[model samples]
Target: MRHLFFALAPDAALRDAIANDAARLHLAWGGRATKPAKLHMTLRFLQGFTDPLPDDVVAAARAAGDAIASVPFAFELDRADRFGRRIGWLGCAVTPRPLQALHDALTESCRAHAVPMREEERFVPHVTILRDPKRAVPSAIAPLRWQVDGFVLMASAEGAYEVLGRWALRA
Candidate 1:
């Protein structure tokens, strides 16, 4: 089974800024910095598949992409939050309506193909900084403001993710 999702990754310049902020935060909290390459905001997680994606699933994702048009969004770093014993993340505040609409469309598409959705808590969009064990949350992390022009389908194997396909938002 492969874990799949759509996300927006920071561009090179923004990534560098994020890296610096992450390093500073790590120092303050006595934790290691997040890998520069792994920084992204997951739009959704399509979970629990036993094999490669079915043709219907790809079509559904395409349709969902067609339903979403490009929109500008700004992200702000507010504070630090921890999730049970799993993760410590930097909280983000942003206009969520666009993301919510996109998620709804994608969910509906997946359901139409009879793809059972993952049983998990509702989606709350966030960018993770640290995972497992105790990690310090910096008093301030870099604030990121960028536009999400599209989403990509990604597959994860052996802890590494590869981009399967990217769907540009409809204009």
Candidate 2:
């Protein structure tokens, strides 16, 4: 069974910028800075198949992906914070409406198609920048703004992600 989820990732330029900031933060916080390739904001985590993912499940997920009606949108992350003691992350000071709408649309579409959604705590849109930091007190950072035009369905294993599908947000 593939561990699958939907996520939005930055372009290489923005990724490099984020990685650089993470490196600087790591020097102060003493932790592993996230690799540029692994930086992303998770949208939804889907249930894993008991067996290999069946064709119908894949179809339902694709149908859900295709049904999203959100257009390209932008958001900014202006502060750094930690989750527990391990996950040092960058997060928006406020959740953008378009981001929430997109998440809601995806949820509704998945429900319509009978795709099982993984149970998770309340969504907090964020991107991990460092892991196992000595300490990451809430601090202001130069804003990292993202123009989100598309998202991907990914299969995760062995610390890598494989894109199963990519969908452009509707305009």
Candidate 3:
């Protein structure tokens, strides 16, 4: 049993770009930048209401991952804002259709497999780039294009993310 979710991880090049963006955003917005290795866009965060879930739940989540059939897509992150006063984030100017399709497919598949998605109602695609920022007013950044090719299942337990499975989004 492990706390798990599905995420869209950037490739090396994209990670580098995000890291650079994070550095600049942190300087302007004033929060600690998220490490380069830890930058990723979460697709679906599975909730078992606990850190470790049951094996049956894990199996269901895996089966849901097996059901994904989304194609590749491109999206751009061009804005920065705060969830509240503490968290600063970078988000796309517009939600990509293929990205939405992939998320919708994952939601449907997870629902069919009895994986509870308590947070699905408010799905916003964004990446957390800074934490505990000093000043956060909605600001615009230069657009950074991300070519998404696949997504993955991730397990996190002590504030670190670990990839458990990978699934390619194909045409």
Each prediction's total of clashing residue pairs, residues at least 3 apart in sequence or on different chains, is 0, 0, 0
The total of clashing pairs for model 1 equals 0
Question: How close is each model in CA RMSD to the real structure?
Answer: 2.9, 1.7, 1.9
Candidate 2 has its poorest 10 consecutive residues by lDDT at 49-58
CA displacement after TM-score superposition, residue 107 of candidate 3 (Å): 0.6
Error of 1 at 37 (Å): 1.3
Top of the candidates by lDDT? 2
> Per-residue CA lDDT of candidate 1, range 1-171, in tens?
777777777778766766666665656554445688887767767764656766676566555555555555545555555666566666554436777777776677666655446655776666676666265543444455556666777766656677867766655
Q: Which ranges in model 3 have alpha carbons more than 4 Å from their true place?
A: 48-53
lDDT tens digits, residue span 1-171, model 2: 667778898899888878888888888888888878988888888998654567787788888998887789998878888899989988887888988888778888989989989987777888899999996778988998899999998877667777888999867
Candidate 1: clashing pairs of residues: none
Ranking by lDDT: 2, 3, 1
Q: Which consecutive 10 residues in model 1 have the weakest lDDT in total?
A: 133-142
Q: Which stretches of candidate 1 lie over 4 Å from their true place?
A: 30-33, 50-63, 70-72, 133-142
lDDT of 1: 0.64
Model 3 Cα lDDT, one tens digit per residue, 1-171: 356788989899988988887888788778688888888888888874465556787788889999988778888988887888878888876777877888888999999999876575666889888989887878788888888888988887676887877888787
